[model samples]
Target: MMLLLTQQAYADDWGCQVMLCMSNPAGPMAVAECVPPMQRLYDAMSRKGFQWPTCDLAGKPDTPKPFKLDARPQVPGNLAPQTTGQ
Candidate 1:
């Protein structure tokens, strides 16, 4: 006998200044839940030193860019794909 496992996926989301960071963690959520989690993701990525399309949420570069979401894997510290986003 064989068993198959299906993967769960979250809705694609974009957050922060510009369409900078995107996330699809776990499964889908209500529209209200998107921003906070996405903000948390940006925080995590910032802590991990992701070196592109950054934003200073506390200060300038406050212009909101048109929202866009890309299905790209989160790559941090220029490490291998197998490495966690940390």
Candidate 2:
């Protein structure tokens, strides 16, 4: 069905972004754009009876496993930082 394909398309896009973001040597926190997609994936995984979405084009499904967000120290003058401070 068109609806299923549409959903799959969004999932693939989100999965690919998650893959690239998680792979960044600077870490996903350093990539501002990574948050939303990662959050979406995290939410889905957190739900009961979660199913892993197919992301063949994004590479191995086993990779980019959900990770805890690291706490970063707050810097003066910066109103906001991507990650919460310890």
Top candidate (lDDT)? 2
Worst 10 residues of 1 by lDDT: 12-21
| Per-residue lDDT over 2-79 for candidate 1, one digit per residue giving the tens place of the 0 to 100 score | 999985433332334223323333433334545565566667677766643444442356754444676567778876
Residue-pair clash count for candidate 2? 0
TM-score of 1: 0.22
Number of the predicted model whose TM-score against the real structure is largest: 2
Residue pairs in clash, model 2: none
Reference-based lDDT, each prediction:
0.49, 0.69
Residue pairs in clash, model 1: none
Clash count per candidate: 0, 0
- Consecutive 10-residue window with the lowest summed lDDT within model 2: 1-10
